[model samples]
Target: MVNNILPFDDSDLTKMITRQINRSWNFSSKVEDKLSTELKDLIRQMLEPDANKRPTITKVLRHPWLRDTSGVTGISLTAKTSNVVGKKK
Candidate 1:
């Protein structure tokens, strides 16, 4: 949908990827002592826009926040169901 809405091609995609990676890194850096090497690299892969180079959904599932499922009842059931369904596929 964003691709359709924006007049972006491969080069623009790369710039957006770079900007997102930098933004994430900056935010993480402010809150933590340092990013683990693995997370830094994974974030790089996550921001990759190339159809082949981006991380898979399952790879993203391994993120630390997703490992915990208890005590987070703030989200709606519909959102939860969509999250579950997205992981299943």
Candidate 2:
């Protein structure tokens, strides 16, 4: 989840909405330093405010960074996630 860092994080709800609306937050130097180019690019694409500009689930799944499935098995929550796995929506 992008290092679990929230670029739009703010204590003020309105400010957080504004930041998300404007897409104005930049990753901090430390976070930027830790990200690879491919991952950064993917995050930017996913963050596009315009829904039409955003990548589809298929496209996201096909991204070079995500395509690396090594050591990644089916998701689990503690080999268990949300206790809602396989639950009917």
Candidate 3:
């Protein structure tokens, strides 16, 4: 005999999706740093199921994370000999 379980319902799936999206925001929100209300609002917009409310990649790229990547750029500090010296190793 085979047993099958029905897939999650729409409301359940939406709740799961929103929880995942909000997890990212909730994490960033806790940081003692500058997190613009616009950025938070943009995240909300992007996470919306209705595409009309979503922001374009270009608009999201304009966010502080990309616009000011210096703070978050994960450049490893190691001495390596290469033609390109300053690049992250």
Best by TM-score: 2
| Ranking of all predicted structures according to TM-score, beginning with the best and ending with the worst | 2, 1, 3
- Output the better candidate (1/3) by lDDT: 1
In model 2, which runs have C-alpha deviations exceeding 4 angstroms? 68-89
Which 10 consecutive positions of candidate 2 have the poorest summed lDDT?
76-85
Q: Highest lDDT, which number?
A: 2
Candidates' TM-scores? 0.37, 0.64, 0.35
Cα-based lDDT for every prediction: 0.52, 0.74, 0.47
| Residues forming the 10-long window of minimal summed lDDT in candidate 3 | 1-10
Please report the TM-score between candidate 2 and the true structure: 0.64
* Distance from true location, Cα of 76 in model 2, Å: 15
lDDT of 2 by residue, 1-89 (tens): 55567777679999888877798877677678899898888988888878998997667766887766567887532324225443567
Show pairs that collide, candidate 2: 76-81, 77-80, 77-81
Clashes of each: 0, 3, 0
Q: Who is ahead in TM-score, 1 or 3? A: 1
Error of 1 at 63 (Å): 6.2
* Decoy 3 TM-score against native: 0.35
